[model samples]
Target: MSSKLRSIRAGHRSVISRLLKKFEDIRDDGDEPVNTEELTKIVNNLLKKQETLQKLNEDILENLDEGEVEAEIVDSDEYAYTLDGKITQIQKLILVNTSTLSTNAKDFRQL
Candidate 1:
């Protein structure tokens, strides 16, 4: 895998770990006048991290090889529609393939 991909994955992991730790801390402090201000700060921090992660994911997708995967021009509504259509097509293909595998398994059992 590329260094960029590795870095992005690592960043995602770090954010998730931090979020989990924050939740654990809150849980451990159970029911004794929870500090609303501190909880708000934690939530805001996580939201910022999530926004950063979204931007990173968008950058990675935008920089992907255009030749290997047809790059969707997120700048246009038509391109967004095309992407949604492609995703639906892929979902249908997966469903069809799964059904075919099940049928094949049944045939094998009958042999």
Candidate 2:
């Protein structure tokens, strides 16, 4: 049981570390025309990992006592909400940057 718990925790940490690295990469590339295909792939991968982590967390909580599980659930929900918000912000930034690039391209062509 302890080994299973440790594995779950390690998996959770790995997912979170990967997500953070992706987020940093996006931010660092800010306003530069990013490859939309690559961005989409990264986002999809991150979401899949996040969903898996959430499911694993739920499984772990099911084995714990009510009070302890409740506390963990609250924290997990808050973290998930924050991650969702960050992802939304990143998506919006990409959209805005792409639009600006498109408009600039049109202006260059007209000149």
**Could you give candidate 1's per-residue lDDT for residues 1-111 as a string of tens digits?**
335853875676576566547645754665654444555555556556555655665666666676633433343235335434533443443345345456536355544
Per residue, candidate 2 scores C-alpha lDDT tens digits across 1-111 of 635964876776677667667766866875765666665666676677678768877777877777787777887788788767766766776576567456536355544
lDDT to native, each model: 0.52, 0.69
What TM-score goes with each of the models? Answer: 0.46, 0.68
Q: What is the C-alpha RMSD of each candidate to the true structure, in Å?
A: 16.3, 5.0
Clashing pairs in 2: none
Worst 10-residue lDDT window for candidate 2 reads 102-111
- In terms of TM-score, the best-performing candidate is 2
Candidate 2, position 81, lDDT: 86
In model 1, state the lDDT of residue 109. 57
